[model samples]
Target: MKDPIATMKSFNRQFQLGKPEIEAVEWAWPQEQGETMFHIINVYTKAAQFPRLTAESGYRLQRVGGMILGMVN
Candidate 1:
């Protein structure tokens, strides 16, 4: 990965707001504690797909993952 934050931002950018399917998926996720677990799964999936990611990029992903985990906690 070039930049994890950038990757996440790009992923989010691709997200279509106001799309009922996405909203429904989000709503389907379990509340409260589930968000952190979900983001951890997200980061793991990203890492598995992009194993050659740069150090800073990986760090950024972990950092963001941590932030997400914190917020969800």
Candidate 2:
């Protein structure tokens, strides 16, 4: 996808890489020892997409499967 920030894994990788734009991260609760922890990473618009996106630019999710990330204006 043109906007790498459009997906959960990509955004998580960004967070692991210390991307400053990551606003916050949400982790699945009820953590169990040795169990995989799921995450929901929140971030603002992609730097490359910020300029091109607009209130009128129209919202579009590159994908519709799984737990899709949410968008805000």
Candidate 3:
């Protein structure tokens, strides 16, 4: 979790163009399982010649009774 901006910069370097400009980064704990999560919002330039806004989130959850439960969008 150290230097998240640096991580985003590295990720943007992997693309030739249409690099996403970070808008915001939010940290939250929405579950009782004590898992840390992060949400990122950004805007990508030159995507189909138009700027596109996007939001992404990442987290890890445990499995119960051999069933994995999580949500992604």
Summarize candidate 2's per-residue lDDT along 1-73 as a digit string, tens digits.
3333245446445334223222221121112112211222112222213333343221221121112343321
How far off is residue 52 in model 1, in Å?
Answer: 2.2
Residue-pair clash count for candidate 2? 0
**Tens-digit per-residue lDDT, 1-73, candidate 1:** 3344454444434432223322322332232123335643365334423445556545554454455555554
Between which residue pairs do clashes occur in model 1? 1-53
Candidate numbers sorted by lDDT from highest down: 1, 2, 3
lDDT of 3 by residue, 1-73 (tens): 4554454345344432232222211111111112221221121211212223343211101111011112222
**TM-score of every model versus the real structure:** 0.38, 0.19, 0.28
Candidate order by TM-score, decreasing, is 1, 3, 2
**Lowest summed lDDT window (length 10), candidate 2:** 24-33
Sequence-dependent TM-score of model 3: 0.28
Task: For candidate 3, give the lDDT of residue 53.
Answer: 33
Candidate 3: global Cα-lDDT? 0.24
